[model samples]
Structure formats: structure tokens, C-alpha cells
Target: MPGLYHICYLSVAKLSALQPTPELGFEAIKEKTRKANSAAGLTGCIIFTGQHFLQVIEGIQEDVEDTFGRISRDTRHTDVRVLSEGPIEVRDFPEMAVNCGGDETLTAEALAEISAVLDYPQHQLHIREIRTLLSVLTQPSRKQDALLAG
Candidate 1:
């Protein structure tokens, strides 16, 4: 019933601020993403910023990681950067979705702390964006909560 998942943010190349392409725009592929993931039984979130794509895939660890590997080789995009990848004791996300405005800043220290927060329950945590989610968990203020969130 529970398994690991992979969370990564792919920073795509630059695009027009005034007029961006649908492939890179966060608002352009909502329905398509949801339908595709739903059909494939793959749950994840895709954050598009008209430049980069932050996708979090949650499923059986093997399936999710394999999918990430597949995406890395996909010829549809140019740049593919891996933000995070590992086996979570629990599912950080149990479904596929996407959102915009994930502009929170983070540090290497915070990223390390976040590594412990991924095993949290959906409602016990207040994090929505991937960056902030990792930052908050890594914070000392959140260290204690990580156990509770888990």
C-alpha cells in the first residue's frame, strides 16, 4: 500500500517572458498531464515556469525512478536537471497534479534537512511547493516536525 517516490525539478532552457510556448508554460498542460498520468496509473506533479519543469513522481520506487530515467532520455526537451531522487518510506505525493509559482529559495543545508521530510503525511505538513517543502523540513524548527509529519 505504501512505497517510495521520486521528486525532481527539471530546469528547462529560457523562453519568452512576454509570449511563451505551451510546452514550457505552467498553465498550458494541466489537463493533458493529469489525463496522461491518470491513465498510466502514475501520480506526480509538474511545475512549469515557461522555462523549467519541476515534476514530482510518486509510485512504487522502481516505477517512478524508471519513469524519471525515461523522461531524462525524452527527446521532447533539451535540458533535464535532477533535483531529488530516492526511496521514501512513505509517499510524499500520492497523485498526479501541477501548479505554478514555486519560486521559493533554498540552501544546500535546507535541501539536506528536506531529505528527511519526504516521508510525511499529506495533511500533517503545510508545504505545497517542492522547494519550500524541503527548506522548511530542513530548518531546525521543522526537524522535530519531520518525525510527526512522517
Candidate 2:
């Protein structure tokens, strides 16, 4: 069996004008994504900062690559830049296809961090920055654990 892998990317959201409302647009995307990811046995989280999207996907190497390829070609996203990716000993989100509903403050902090590093040369992003983003973005997983624990 192939080892586990993950890919993290950031992109700007470009919603079509035809969508009746932003909530509807997001809900549609979330439903579609949930189905697709679940079918492919992939797991990850998607964070939307009102205008941009930060996502992390993990699974078998081929599945992760295939998912990222589709995401890169999707028209709703622009300026899709990968932050980090590599083999992982374990999955950060083992049971979730797409984690959502994060704390507002942490999401805002994550957006600020990503924006600050957006101008930096892609290769120049420090490991610390990547770690920080992962830590904050995965906060929802912790909440999920607590809810299940209770």
C-alpha cells in the first residue's frame, strides 16, 4: 500500500455572479467536496477567510495528487499556490472529508499569517510559518475531539 501524503494550498475564491447568495454558493461547494472526498477516501479541512481559501488534503499519494490536480484546474479558484506537501506518518484528519466551522479568532489569525507570507517568495516560507498555519488550521480537529469525548 502507498504511504500517506498531504498537500496544503491557498487560493482566492471567485464566486460566480449567478449564485443567488454567498451562503448558498459555499454550501454547494461544501456538499460537492464532501461527497467527492469521502468517495476517494481522502481527508482534510477547508478554511475560507471571506475572500480566500486555505485547504489541506491528505490520503494515498496518488489520491492526494489527483485531488490537488482537480483543485488546481477548478475555475472557482485563482492564484492557487501550494504551501507545503510531503509524506506523513499519520493523517491529521483521519475521519473528516472536510473540516469546517472554526473559531473566528483563529481563522482571522490564520488569514493574517497567510496574507503576511503571500508576498514572500514561495521558496522563502519558513518552516515555522508552515507549522504555525497547520497548528491553527487544525484547531477544529481538536474541537471535534472534545465534542466526541463529551
Candidate 3:
């Protein structure tokens, strides 16, 4: 079988009744996204910082591309920009999809961390930075508080 690939992208949310109320809307989106991802045999994580979204998905190339295509056409998002994509020997996230909800302080910090790497030359991001980004996005909420504390 062909190896899986990971694709990361960032997007801004379009104005909508649900978009305006992030807490509720984010959960709704996450729930729907999780269900779809599960059915598609994809696994990864997504972070929503109220206005912006960042997601990393891992799966067969066709499935990943199809999922991304559907996401791009979804009415909820705008300004979709792909950050990175390439084949991987192993899945970084092999289980359930993770949804990192909006927490102002943590979100700001995480965005700053992600932006630094993204601002680098295209596809030139250091492996360490990529791992760090995954760590930041995948940290559980309980551990996230500890992350902020230390």
C-alpha cells in the first residue's frame, strides 16, 4: 500500500450566525468534522482560534485531497491557504481527531508559534518546528494549562 501523507492548512472563518458564537459553533463544527473524518478513515487535529483555523490531516492522498476540497468549498471558511503537504511513513495522529478549542491566551501563543514556522520559506520548515506545532496543537486541555504555566 502507498504511504500516507500529511496536509496542513489555515483558513479564516466567514461571517455567519454560528461563526459569531464561537464556543457553540466550534463544538458543532468539530463534532461534524470528527464524524466525517472518521467515516473517511482520516485522523488528525484541528485548532480554532475564533477567527482562524488550522488543521493537519493524515491519510491516503486521494482521501486527504478530497476532504480538503470539500472543506475549501464549505461555506464556513474563507481565505484557505495550504501550509505544507508531503508523504509520511507513519501517522502522527493515528487515533481520534483532536479539536483544540479557542482559548484566548493559548490560542495567541499557539498562533505565534505556528506563524513563525509558516513564515519561513515554502516547504522549508524545520522538522523540529513541525513537531513542536503538532505538540502544541495536540496537547490536551488539561496539559495545555500546564504548558502555559511552564
Candidate 4:
């Protein structure tokens, strides 16, 4: 009951909120989440790609569950689906309360493929894949930087 637990989920962003710039309203949300999560002793990361959000939250069982519940009710997200959740021996992100990543966006089709993989009966085996994908996607891309600078 009282142990370190983690939950990962994927959700579509409310199109309207994305607005003129997806970061405009979402930056505030991210800051609020970071502060609240820090206060609750939680650590995790959120990856947003203009359309979808993939997040991993880890902490005390109750705290992680409560945060997920609150996020499910948040108006900014839609089609919320838990990708994976269970007790973890250690945290993947121990230092950051919340890390937001969107350097490389995932296509809708790719997201669907990932969701399918994690939804299968042998989903556990693929857990690390998703985490690794998140880690790679989170990294800032020099190619993107160059394009932006050009």
C-alpha cells in the first residue's frame, strides 16, 4: 500500500487550448504541476507534441494515484489513457519534479502504434521501450536547433 509507485499516461491536448501557441497556456500548467508535484514529493516528466501529452509520474502510491485522478479531470486534456502503472523499485526521474519535452514530436499514427504495443497482453515487456522512447524524445535536437537558428 505505502510504497513507491509510478504511473504513465497518454492524452490528447484540447485543441482550443493549443491556440496561437501550444506553450502559451501549457507553460503555466507545467509550472503549476512542477510546484505541486515538488510539494508532494513526486518526480516525473511530461512530453508534449503539440497534440498529445505523455507523462510519467512516480512517488508514494497514494500521491501518484491522486495526481493522476486530478489530471484526468483537468479540462486541458482529453482521451486520457493510462499507459502503465505499478510499484517501482526506484524512480526514473528522482531530481526533477516535472520535465517537459517536445523537441521531437510523435505523429498520431506513431502514438497509436505505441498505445497498441502497451495495450497488448505482454505489455510489461515493452515498458522499457516506452520509457526509452520518452528519454530519447525528451532530449533537445541539434538539428531542430539549427533549423530554428537558420
Candidate 5:
């Protein structure tokens, strides 16, 4: 049962100015990430706060690790620090290979929630808490279902 579950990780990185505009660069990055993640059977959400990127990825152990490996090497990400990683019984993001686009309010809420979870020392985090945090951050509201709950 444990092996059948998905591996999830939270990471934060500085955004790089690789395109003419941050929005343009983010779109390109997200497009590439979505396609690659779908091919790898991965699922997750990424929240960009203009200055930084916070993301969570979930998939089979090897697939998740491999995806992270590629992401870590990408020039667009810097100071990538994984906040937490482990196996989970359920996927926090079951529908999307990658979820990135949203208004600034959504981004702010997600970042604040993530910050609250990370406020605990890494070693102090429990698997259940991690799962809960991911669920809370990634779950789309009823109104957003039409747009993000694919």
C-alpha cells in the first residue's frame, strides 16, 4: 500500500528573468512543465508570487525524483530548497499535471498557507500534516471547479 502511494515534495525557488517579462517566462515554464509532468504521470500545483516559486509535485517515487532532478537543473530556478518530501496515500492534485495560473489573491493565499505549514521545523512535520496542507492549498473551490478542477 505504501509503495502504491505517490511521493510529494514542496520546494521554493527564486524566479529567473529568462524571458522579456516574468509573465511570459512563467507561461513558457508552466507549459513545458505540464507537458513533461503529464508524460511522466505526475501531478502538482505551483504558485508564483512574482518574486518566488512554490511548488508541490506528486507521483511514483522514481518519477517524482526524476522530475525534480530535471527541474533542479533548469536555469530558471535558483536556490531550490525542498521543504518536505515523502509518500502520501492520496494525491493533493489529482486532476492537473501542473496548476499555475490564477489571480494574485489565490497566489497569496496559497503562499500564506504554505508558509504556515513550513513554519514548523522540517523534522517536526508529520506525513498527515503534509498531506493536509497540500490538500488545502491545491483544492479548488466550487466556483473554481469549472476552471481548475479538470
Candidate 6:
């Protein structure tokens, strides 16, 4: 069977959510990914900024496609935009990967904040607030390609 290469753009921001610093928060999230990937036998790379995240997950063609689609509404993500997708003959993340440390900062509080917004009264959801939230939860994932090259 041929492996597959995939990239996903996910936006998650935690302006003041994570305690301490981004490096610590990144560590926390990476740990979670590690466990999840192990359980599912999936491989991928994840990157984060204070305002967004880009990830590339690969595995069985069917499984990878299904998994990538599920991230659209993942609890960890708020506003998701699928910038691009394509098929490949090999796994991009042969064994799951992550790069978050050494001066790396984290941002994903916006995703949590948006989830909270859903609890508010419907009338309170302003257009501007939604737009801001989208921006906060939107991240470009082009670097995922570079991650492999790097």
C-alpha cells in the first residue's frame, strides 16, 4: 500500500489561556498529540503559534482522509479552514512529529474562547466578534511542507 501526505490548517489561539509560557503550552499539546497518535497508529506534524496551528497527518489513505476531516470540528480547534488537500504515495509523518520548543510561543486560547461564546445568549454574538474569532482560529499550514524538508 502507498502512504499518503496531507496538510491541514487549523486556527487556535489562547491569548491568556495557557499558564506560564508558550513553550510549556506547546509541550502540553504535543503530549496529547503523541498519545492520540499512538492509540490510533497515525503519524503527522503539528506546529503552533499564539494565533494558529498547522498540521500534517498521514497514514492509510482512508484513515488519513477521515481523520483530517474530523479536525474541522475538533474540540481543540475553533474556526477551521481547509486551505488545500491532495493525495500522496507515502506517509509524510511516518511516525508522528511535532516542533514546539526553543523559543517557540503558543497561542490557542481563542478556540476555547469561541467554544465559550456558544454558551452565551444568541443575541450577544456580534459579527465582529465572530470575525475576530475566525481570525484567531485561522492558521496557515504551508510550513508543514517545510517541516519535512527541515
Best by lDDT: 4
Instruction: Write one digit per residue (lDDT tens) for candidate 1, span 1-150.
Output: 645566565545345531265443434445665665566566665544434455677667766667777767655445676667776665444533433223232333433344334323352333345645533433446644653564
TM-score for candidate 2, residues paired by index: 0.72
The better-scoring model by lDDT among 1 and 5 is 5
Higher-TM-score candidate among 1 and 4? 4
Mark the regions of model 6 whose C-alpha exceeds 4 Å error after superposition: 1-5, 14-23, 95-150
State every prediction's TM-score relative to the real structure: 0.51, 0.72, 0.75, 0.74, 0.68, 0.52
Task: Put down candidate 6 lDDT per residue, 1-150, tens digits, no spaces.
Answer: 565655545456454554467557666777876776677667765656445555666566676677777766555566675544567566544533443322332234433343444444463445334332333223235423423342
Q: Candidates ranked by lDDT, best first?
A: 4, 3, 2, 5, 6, 1
Error of 3 at 39 (Å): 1.2
Candidate 3 structure quality by residue, lDDT tens digits, 66-148:
99999899888888988788898887778775545456336567566555544455645555455456655576655466456
lDDT of each: 0.51, 0.71, 0.72, 0.76, 0.65, 0.52
> What CA RMSD would candidate 2 show?
5.5
Tell me how far the alpha carbon of residue 78 in candidate 3 is from the true structure, in angstroms, after superposition: 1.0
Candidate RMSDs in Å, in order, are 10.1, 5.5, 4.1, 6.1, 5.5, 10.4
Worst 10 residues of 3 by lDDT: 97-106
Per model, state how many residue pairs clash.
2, 0, 0, 0, 0, 8
CA lDDT, candidate 6, residue 75: 59
* lDDT by residue (tens digit), candidate 2, 54-120: 7888899899999999989988788998888999898877878877533443445545555555545
Write out the backbone clash pairs for model 4. none
lDDT of 1: 0.51
1-150 per-residue lDDT for model 5 (tens digits): 224235444444444455867777777788898999999888887766565566788888888888888878877777677766777777778899987634533655545444555545554466566545445555656423422442
**Cα deviation of 57, candidate 1, in Å:** 1.1
Local accuracy of candidate 4 as per-residue lDDT tens digits, 88-150:
998888878887764335445544554554445465435576676665544456423432442
TM-score of 5: 0.68
In candidate 4, which residue ranges exceed 4 Å CA deviation?
18-20, 103-125, 137-150
